[model samples]
Target: MSSKSTQTQFDKNMEFGNDTTELIRYITKGDGAGLAYQWLSTLVDGFGHRMVGSDSLEEAIDFLVKSLEEDDFDDVHTEEVPNLPNWVREDDNVEIIEPRHQRLNVLALGGCEPANITGEVVVIRDLDNSKFVNVSGKIVVTAQQFKGYPQTVKYRQSVKLFESLGAIGVLIKSVTSFSINSPHTGSGAEGARIPAASLTVEQADMIDRMFQNGEKIVIRMNMKSHSENHTTTSRNLIFQITGAFRPVNWLSHLSFSGDQQHVNLFKMKRLDEIVHLLNRNGILLGLVNNPSQGDVRFWAKDGIPSVNYIPDKAIDYYFYFHHTGGDYITIFKDGDLEYTASIFAVLGHIIANMDNWGPA
Candidate 1:
């Protein structure tokens, strides 16, 4: 971290003490809380799921630009992100056909090329590419448990190897430790295009048990999802709070879709300063020097010191509702969203006010 003042970092708190204190108050306990959640409620409820190529995403972006501009944020705008991959879920049907009958919940993953196929079941509770067989003309059913999303999603999404082995389709157990028969959807890996859908954890486990008990299992996956048109249409919504000092030194509002989001601090001494500020103000969150995902990679690749704030209440239930029908505005606790906003508000204020970029 770089600083102009000779004072030690903690004493530097004296610099932002009064300003940050009031900013925290205004955001957490003042009208800002109501206004922030109001905007969030409108976006999540009014627009619904904002997947690429869907009208909901465009509407959500439009709403953000409009709301931010109306609030008089400086240089509020939407920038076009072109040539991105686009996938949309239209309809799906997953069912056990050979022995009795059951319909399973499903969400066709992003980047899954459309197909309709029926294959014999090969339930693999643990999947490893190097050690596998009997999946050539089968629906590979997986109930790989949740270790962590970054680790577990690989089993769910990485299907190129399975594709190469002549697997027709895949049904991944929702990548979460606990579930009430809720399915979770996410982006498939880059190369695998076989039709795939996420199955509820309960469904995957049941299928695995049936296979273990010597039952001849076969399933039919009839999907009508598409990404046929080559052109991908999406927007990166942005609003800039111009720096009063050092205009070239600016931070951005990080926007991401799907699971890839991370932040790396690059050993900036000023990072410590903001951590102290959050501690003083009583905001609890998980922090890491190098996290694995998109927001961090995008900024860090361009030599920018950006912070990706993921609000964790420590119970780790985020995956339970993500990308499913259960993903709703009601998931957030009272003042939860506002507190997150306050963390960014404080960091943005400090970063915008700094005279130099840190740890460059």
Candidate 2:
């Protein structure tokens, strides 16, 4: 991979030293559990729907700026930019104009031209150039079919294509489960977007059946879906953290074999020694995995393999802790019951008996 990408990737994975963890833990404990829960709850709840250019987006920005500032973040800011048009469903309705008249469900397509008059519907097998003679000045109804989004949406824009041939409106087979005469609407774009709507599958089937039976099926559609030019804007917020005695230390050489069960023994032993050592010297040894291993290279094989401890996100920290539960061996080390390695076997063998067991 390129050095820039590698560096960009590395910057995200790195975290602080033991002092950082101690500091975080101390801060959390000092604030009490209730306050912590309240902070998180407010952060998620106050944001609401953050869709660009919407009221929710503005509210979320103000909430973040205030919360981060209160949380002691030195600088918090937002970058503004124009947002895309957000179409919404306004109103819709559909009805069979002939052949056992009935109301069918329908919806308006976004960004479509308004209908001057509720037009009559005409059932057609297809809308190729050849069908223009019979479809002019009437709503064309047909079974909608497509393979994907952009492709499927062609039916929604069928009205505009038909309009070029002097057609009025387009009625599509509702692309939904169970026909309730209900129409579903969606956004569409064109030179001069035309009004479009959908009918339930059942209603579509009835219309097609009439055509197959040599009977003309007609329907009336009244849909209200329009778009207006509006200034849309959105915001992007950013924050950063700071520390004084920042240090980067590389830990290596310590190695072991066996499943996590065995690893826990080593972990307990190290934790006990480190904590006692720290307490005695008025210094702290933070037990943390090397954060640099988060690079994509760690997962990519074949190259010179990096053995730095994988970042916490790569491994299930909670699972490891739970799996090691009750397996830890504690010892009276320097007047404190610290975690130790009394339960683990050396090279998978039980050697030293009870009394012979002493600090190695």
Candidate 3:
């Protein structure tokens, strides 16, 4: 063996000089496997669906921050989080008063203004192409289905659709297949608007029959709706790590740091969604779609709630590192459409050397 090889072996055997060993020791010991599992399982599965502003979400954030501090990370803190306003359903009722009076199924639209007075209901084909010019100050009924329910509902959205036409309120046929004489209430647009409600298919059909018979259909609507706005708390989480060093090539690497870069291939939880959406729109973002041709890497387990750090040195620094202009990355859950149908996100942390950077 050469003199350098023999000397390196002797140093390792005697534990004389090994800076790399110390760096690995710090990370592996600091974030042991068993401890990692415990921390993640307790947060994700145990807490289950921690919605923003909920007490459960706040508790989870507290747990995360405390755990980090326990691991000896310093200067850990949070940034302010913003969220949309909440709208809730209130009491609502609808009924046919003529051509055999009967109780009708009904639901109030979200954000509908409270009604201090009950009003007569008038059914019509369209609010814009209305045959009734002075139909204002009455509950207008229309037959149209609003798209994107639950996420972007429009069950009670007519308050704004016909308010300027002198409409005081609105009643729409429920946007569903089977009518159990049940009305479905959902979110409505903001501001001073008229109250809106829904009616069952049976009741709507009955109205259509009345219109066919040339009999004026009379109905009534009563609603009590309002809202309250207040400040609430939220959370933003982060996972961090240290970088590796090459003592032998330190001078050369530093001199080329600005131009040379690294290419990182991240496996997202929802990669399929990303691929499908991007392909559907005929858009490309420098990503390889096929798994066989893609970079092979290890991903953290579902039970492991924390982020994994994979060291990648294959990328040429001049062309790859920080090429996207942003530091965030995303992981898409392939089949899970219920929670984040399109993507899940992550951020990167690269350090010059472990000893140089620390908690701040």
Per-prediction CA RMSD (Å): 4.7, 18.5, 15.7
Q: What is the TM-score of each candidate against the true structure?
A: 0.87, 0.44, 0.43
Cα error, candidate 2, residue 81 (Å): 4.0
Clashes of each: 3, 6, 12
What ranking of all candidate models by lDDT puts the best one first? 1, 2, 3
Tens-place lDDT digits, model 2, residues 80-173: 7765665444555667766667877665655565554556556755445425547677777766543333344466556666767666777766
Q: Which lDDT tens digits does candidate 1 get at residues 1-360? A: 234543434345446655667888888887676777788788888987777777888988888888888888787777888887676678788899979799988878777777778889987766674245678888888877688777787877657767877888988888887788888888773467688888999999999899999999989988887775786868887777876555543366332223333222323456666666676677764455554444377765655454666666442577777777888888888888888887888778877766654343
Per-residue lDDT for 1-360 in model 3, tens only?
A: 245543332134432223323323333343332343445557766665454456677888888888887886545567667664444445666666765577667666655656643455566654445545466776666654333232223434556766767877777665554334555444453564676766555676667567656876666666765554653557666544433342211110101111111212222312222333333322222233322221121211111112221222222221121212111122112222211111111111112222221122
List where candidate 3 sits over 4 angstroms from the true fold.
1-88, 131-134, 145-156, 176-182, 229-360
For model 1, what is the alpha-carbon lDDT of residue 359?
Answer: 40
The local distance difference test score of each candidate is: 0.73, 0.47, 0.45
Q: lDDT at 242 for candidate 1?
A: 75
Worst 10 residues of 3 by lDDT: 249-258
